[model samples]
Target: MATHGQDPLLHSEVRQASTGGYFAGYAASIVLMLAALLVTQQHVLTYPAFLWVIFSLVVIALVAQAALFFGLGLSPAQAWKSVSLILTLPLFVFTIGLSVWMFHSLAPRVMPDTMPGMDMTQQPTLLE
Candidate 1:
C-alpha cells in the first residue's frame, strides 16, 4: 500500500509514467501495426523475407512499448524488475524459435509437397 503522499504510479517500485511517453508508445504501436499490414497485403517481399521483416518490426514495437508505456528504465527502484524481465526475455525467444524450427523440420517428413490447392490427406481415385 502507498503512503498518503505517494503517487499511485510510484506506489510500486517502478518508474513513473509520463503522458508524452504514453502518447509516443501508442502512436508508434499503431504505425508499426499499419506498416505490418501494408507489407503483408502488398507483398513487398517474397515469402520468408517478408516474414522476417515483419518479425523485426514486431520486436521493435515491443521494445518501444516496454520503454514508453511500461516505463522500463534504469531507475534505481525498478532495477531488479527490469533485470529479471531482461533475463527471461531470451528464454521466451528461444522457446518460440525452437518451436518454429521443430515445426519446419517435421513438415517435410509428415506432409509431402502437394499442389497449392490440393489436400494431402485425400485418398487417390483408382480410375484416374
Candidate 2:
C-alpha cells in the first residue's frame, strides 16, 4: 500500500527536525566549544584541574546536543529513548574513565622519565 516514493519511517510518528531546534543546538555547541577554548588558552585552570574543567564542559555540550539535536527528553514519546540513554550512560562514563586511567598509569612506565632537553635532577620530588 505504500507509494514508491513514500518512506514508512518518515511517517507522522517520527518527529521532524525543527529549524529553530537545529540552530539552538548548533549555537549552544559552538558557545560551549568557545568557552572551553578560552579556558584553555587563558590558563583559567592549572594542569589537572584544567583537564577536569574541559572534560566537564564537553559532557555539558554532549547533553545539550542530545537534547536539542537528537530529541532526547522526558516527554512520553521520548521517555524510552531518554531512559535507555540514562541506563547506558554509566557504561560510557566507565569506559572513558578507565581508558584515561590506563593511559596515565602506563605512560610513565612506557616512556622515558626525562626528555632529551630536560634534566631529571631538576624536577622536584614529592618528598621535597
Each candidate's clash count: 0, 0
lDDT of 2 by residue, 87-108 (tens): 9999998999999999887876
Report the Cα RMSD per candidate. 6.4, 6.3
Over 4 Å off in model 2, which ranges? 1-15, 102-128
* Residue 91 lDDT (model 2): 99
lDDT against true structure, model 1: 0.82
Q: How far is candidate 1 from the true structure (C-alpha RMSD, Å)?
A: 6.4
- Tens digits of per-residue lDDT, candidate 1, 1-128, equal 36788786666534465689899999999999999999989966989999898998999999999888888888776677789999999999899999999988888556655335456566355676
TM-score of 2: 0.66
TM-score of each: 0.73, 0.66
Q: After superposition, how far is residue 75 of candidate 2 from its true place, in Å?
A: 2.4
Distance from true location, Cα of 101 in model 1, Å: 0.7
Cα error, residue 67 of model 1, in Å, equals 0.5
